[model samples]
Target: MSKKNEVSFFDGKGLRNDGRRLDELRPIELEVGVLDNASGSALIRQGGNRILVGVFGPREIHPKHLALPNRATLRCRYHMAPFSVEDRKHPAPSRRETEISKVIREALEPVVFTEYYPRTTIDVYIEVLEANGGTRCSGITAASLALADAGVPMRDLVVACASGKVGGKIVLDLNDFEDKYGEADMPVAILPHLDRVLLLQMDGNLTPKEFHEALDLAIEGSKRIYEMQKKALRDSYPIPDEPQEEEVVEVEK
Candidate 1:
């Protein structure tokens, strides 16, 4: 087997190249109702990644055949702009985009009360204006806020974060450089109030012990992000009772 490249991800001072501690998450900024036209919208900036999500629906499905008979069909599209990354990508949807879209949808479906709006459709559009790494997790975080902004009936808010192993140490929230060279990446999503796992995906290898550590770190990061999500929503509209999914206020923005 070929030898792994020798790269220094952490400095002698125990800080990563980005100057963050192993268990520290990158900076995050969130905004709600950024788009005036959409039923609901949210923008998130996590590290160097920027993702915007717009939610539309609980409205009638376009083609009659696509609508679910018993519950609302959740349709999601995750698209990264051609200029979003270092290397310019094509405008068309790539295979990775397709996969992430499906992943986001599945992660979100469990919380939405689709049964409330039978035969309707809830459409979510995620636009990645920039990507450094961990866009999938960031996307889920923003999408959940957008759904709340749209006043969709949901059992709870979903939040996500990623942790990985780099340089033989597990770290929280991998950046692009670390993800590209790191030994492993695990992105996790959960319903904070419900304490249920909505999504968990891993790439690369880790020992059972390392896996548990990484999962714990990711959950910690997600809980922090969840607080921000609630704050952003509250800033836009009053949150009478948080995590009490039934109290979601319908935002007109």
Candidate 2:
């Protein structure tokens, strides 16, 4: 209830520390099929967060016991580079990363037509090249695009975004500073075409009204991101120009 040692997140002029409005999101850049060797890949930059996602398979599952009888199993691995954050993290997978990987897989499974590839497995790997905040949501966005680029059949593309309460005001897309100091944070993913929520997670505290407002802001942000994702896929494969017919050379012949 008292602002003491907290950093000044908002100025009197209604601008955040990064100079964005409460409802404004950081700039986002997306590219699909970025990796040549992988079946499909995508890279995304949101503010200072950078994530690369690779999708492989629909191939036979190894260790046979892990294979599903009715539908393709979805496996995900979310990792952070040792230098991704200010402090170097261990190269090995941490518990947090494992949990995030599981959540991401569940988030994507609902949209994928896994039944079409029974007894197979689709693997998605997400690597955080740089992390300022909201890596999980960004990873999910990248993974979904990568899956689509890999030619995986899906009901719809999944889009994700986060909204949080910073300086006692609801803000869309929290940066590292906001995430560290914000009172509440919520990350959500959705199937834009179906208007169905695929993932939702929250931390800290919020009232009923604030909760709905934050959720609405996140949904709007995801819709904007959806457009960029589609554009990236389209840009990856440009249409070739039609060849022009040569004029008749009857006289020469």
Candidate 3:
């Protein structure tokens, strides 16, 4: 391993900076319908990364030119708050944000039943209130939950997660530090039930073997996130009480 990859990101016992095992993911907390104003909303926290997503529409599309005649259009906007990071970022949307927004939309479009709502639009907004790393993946995860909460028909929920090579070891769910210095980082979104890759992106250097290892790790991580998404949706609307049976009145009859 070169000096860059030799940093003690992981100790001899195979523990990361935050004491996570090589294949372990950071803790995650998710909730749905967090915003009353939006049709549906979700908030998710993974380690220091926090993302909020809102879904609106299945309504007529404005500016008629933007609507698709055969299917509903899906639009997504991803933004980072000015105070989300250590250095205050400008509130204006940056080029990076725009690209992320596009990818997020594509990641979700596959599962949504767009054909059911022709000439309409479904808008998804993702706000990164705080970011430590893996914000994009977490944002996509939250967006899918928000869409389901809104009652949008879908084939499956999308789940996303990232893995990277740090300290010459493949690790699941890189944090900010790992992302900045890791040898390689790969983020992926998947349709867990079908085991299909919806989105895949990578940066940095990795051997073919390492790349496959990272992909496998990311896929496993996504499955865990998929379960969490299901729990959040179920918790949002608990089962109602069963109706009580009326008493018989044999004597009166």
Candidate 4:
């Protein structure tokens, strides 16, 4: 990685520090409903990065006191694959992952209709198959898709994106180099339907006006991603043909 903050690295002849243009996004690929065992599942590919998300039942609750009297419990787990990073990751959950999981759970709770399944709990699992710069935001995006695919009622689709300043230029959807050396990074989860924000995190430094500009850029990037999520879901599950019944006739001689 470069120094703490430098945009000179992005001077790759009109391309980003990572060789991508300012308006360009990493190539994205998606598949939904991949795990039949789970209520809903999705796999997302954004360039070399991959993430899988699983949604499991509003089933009976455990550790009962945590359960709310009026609503079901929402549980979220975010973990990295052992081989997700350049170095093998430890099997046990890291403090960073745990903190991310906690924050994601909070961001998702308001969108989920937990009240409908009182005394129950729904598990949202995110596994990072590969790592890029924006894994957490990717996890948020995948988890929301999995929940929606599972037929869970939600108020709106949550889309997440990260923005940062590189070489004195504010950019949307940062990549590895930009994030590692960024002056400021703002990651956010936005409700595309309602034009609202749920989760927002900032790292590094920026002026208040610059922060507002970064926030707006993040929201704009998220909206575009939200559209892709909707398209992925629609493509994954086509309308099933009507069931066919076997015709019965007299036994053959």
Off by over 4 Å in 2: 1-5, 241-253
Considering lDDT, which of the candidate structures 1 and 3 is the better prediction for this target?
1
List per-candidate RMSD values in Å: 6.6, 3.2, 3.8, 4.1
TM-scores for candidates 1 onward, in order: 0.92, 0.93, 0.92, 0.90
lDDT to native, each model: 0.93, 0.92, 0.93, 0.85
Q: Model 2, 1-253: lDDT tens per residue?
A: 4552457888889999889999998899999999998889999999999999999988889989999999999999999999999989999999999999999999999999999999999999999999999999999999999999999999999999999898789999999989988898899999898899988999889999999999999999999999998999999998754432222444346
lDDT of 4 at 197: 83
Indicate the TM-score of model 2: 0.93
Q: After superposition, how far is residue 231 of candidate 4 from its true place, in Å?
A: 0.6
What lDDT tens digits, residue by residue, belong to model 3 across residues 171-201? 9999999998888889999999988999999
Best by TM-score: 2
Tens-digit per-residue lDDT, 167-248, candidate 1 = 8999999999999889999999999888899889999999999999999999998999999989998899765666555445
Model 3: pairs clashing at backbone N, Cα or C within 3 Å: none
Ten-residue region with minimum lDDT total, candidate 2: 242-251
- lDDT value, candidate 2, whole model: 0.92
- Top-scoring candidate (lDDT): 1
**Tens-digit lDDT track of model 4 for 124-242:** 99999998888888889899999998888899878888887877778888877678776777789988888778899988888888898888888888888888999999998676554
Q: Which stretches of candidate 3 lie over 4 Å from their true place?
A: 1-6, 240-253
